[model samples]
Target: MRLITQSLLVLALGVGLARADGETAGEFDYYVLSLSWSPNWCIREGDARDADQCDARHDFGWILHGLWPQYDRGWPSFCPTRHRNPSRSDTRAMADIMGSSGLAWHQWQKHGRCSGLSSDAYFALSREAYATVTHPDAFRRLKQPIRLPASVVEEAFLAANPNLSAGQITITCKDGGIQEARICLTRSLEFRDCGADVQRDCNLNRATMDVIR
Candidate 1:
């Protein structure tokens, strides 16, 4: 009888601990605006895929990766929403900043659904959030690949956006190269300090930053 009781208790606890595929929409603490360094991404993975964004014709620099709703600790994704999904034209319009319509659709399906908004509204908010931050011209002017401390990237961003502090942003690295710059914001889109988990910064002394195509 005691063993059966213990087993039942464990089962109950496991069920309670399990996370759902979809969280409730419109409930989150903050947002993370992720900007990918296009050239670095191209070198690492995009070029192999023959991604159009990597083409010299695009001349892409930092592109919008996603505008994600975040919790203070973890984040919500693929949440069920009452709003309708974006149409083909809607996603295509965002390609100018997002690099591809495919990314726009993916972002909407994953992160935007959790915003408690229609796809159009979510994309609009994403664009507005993106425009609020200035991409440092110094990076765009890079004539050749450079290896520099990852912290230099963060400092350049801070200089460009005076309202932003070190706590509000983080730089990430992958494949031995600079990857993305993620900035935290309030629900209202004002700059805010990131949660502890989101505040992890790449401490690379020399991370390669590829030149813009």
Candidate 2:
């Protein structure tokens, strides 16, 4: 039910982004934020009973808080208390996952060509960091993932979000030494939308996964 609801929200958002016409940037951000953050784990853990129970059982130092009367050692509950995520802060964990950033941000500055997609200003990052933020067409550099200061990216999205219509986007480069970035999703982008086979790669909840597709 949670996943289904988030999926519908994304469809509404994409539709809203498309046909809403003539809205302000901030308005767009506000709208998008709802979709971006919908499946966010940290944001919702406070309210979900299953989540709370799981936290108490596994995450909270393997301590059972006794709140969950039906707790079973092996049986899977709706919340699935079997596994617990160790770290919650997104950016830090992703950097660790990527295995030491093969591409240097500074290297991109010296040898990386614009190839007509990325802006020159995006080079604020070092070669290693720049290399980490990659999209499919990394060599052809056509479908490049954006890079900019995180704050810059956030503000730009926030600013232009309200006024956007279909096919419009606000781009920013990563700043603050791009070890990694976990953009605060105001709305949800379901993992399924990212990729059904690789939803775990995205580390998103089912709620987030629903809308991504």
Candidate 3:
């Protein structure tokens, strides 16, 4: 009876750890800062709906998608089922980078609500995370298509940012061009290794990154 009880206790502890790393609402282990390559996004998603971002007037490179809270294998979303409306000041502050008021609100509603932070604090953290990453010069403007191994692209980012490593990020592609760089961060917004399940998504031997002019 004593041995059986001990085994049951160990199993219970393991289960608890697993739950902490699953889709537990309003609770998370870290964050995934998704930096979208704007040129590829425009090409794939079209420029009509988000004309302000995809238009010729704004030559955006890497833009913030969202600071998404993540668990080990999964993440939480639509948490609490209710969210406060973003203030004008916060909305305007995030607009230039996040692309639009609607996108900003949607991000907060889905990802931010699960962050266990208020609207003001969550947006502030998102800005800080965006400022933390340094983009390589090659990525600043892709006047022509640049084809390189996806790992090489990840290395470029690692070289530019001192605190990051190969395991901390994954390069994602779409429509024959690099679409985004999904990087892992601590809850406090420091660079960290992603969970094992966050594998590299681009299968091409060499990937292209199209530049926006």
Candidate 4:
């Protein structure tokens, strides 16, 4: 019995250490494109989605588009712009990272219709490269307003979208900086087009997605 208990304790300790790296849910300010392992994305079914889902080995040939920062335009060889059209396809392409399991994801829609290439957000773990790590403790209790940087991200949003009649950007932060952020979805979400800087006003929504009346 003593030996068995000792072995069990050792096993439990090993498991804990393995997951300790996962405890820290990295800061999620906005969103990231590619995460790790540099996944390969390709087009499928015209409205098809995901890169690795179609090709993996020589899949780099199909990369149409990806999230920002993670997969910036610095590398033209990786982006597949010919097939990427946020106005049409609801899904987009992306590269995956290792140890990124259990990451929360979302799809953006403007004015009740889908808009923008599907971007991803994750909890960074250790380094900025691995910042995609998510916080395990912030679940259910995670309820905070979306905030944008005053001079940088905020000002840009106000200038890009004309729908924001309020012309004001608010930042909701805890440590004097943003940790979580979001704007109201578009009208297609069934929400009214109230005259204020809503969530949709910041990001493209159904109304914004459609250029034609």
TM-score of each: 0.91, 0.16, 0.82, 0.22
Per-residue error (Å), model 1, residue 72: 0.7
Model 2 error, position 41 (Å): 13
Clash count, candidate 3: 1
lDDT per residue as tens, model 3, 13-42: 999876565244568889999988877777
The C-alpha stretches of model 3 lying farther than 4 A from their native spots are 1-25, 48-50, 81-83
RMSD of each: 3.5, 23.0, 8.0, 19.2
Model 1 residue runs over 4 Å out of place are 1-19
Identify the candidate with maximal lDDT. Answer: 1
For candidate 4, what is the lDDT?
0.26
Compose the digit string of candidate 2's lDDT tens values, residues 9-70.
Answer: 99999998766442221111111111111112222442363433223222211110011011
The most accurate candidate by TM-score is 1
Q: Candidate 1: how large is its RMSD?
A: 3.5
Candidates by TM-score, descending order: 1, 3, 4, 2
The reply for model 2, stretches above 4 Å from the true place, is 1-111, 116-122, 125-160, 169-213
> Where is model 4 more than 4 Å wrong at Cα?
1-101, 105-153, 167-170, 187-213
**Number of clashing residue pairs, candidate 2:** 50
For model 3, what is the alpha-carbon lDDT of residue 210? 71
- When summed lDDT is taken over every stretch of 10 residues in candidate 3, the lowest stretch is 17-26
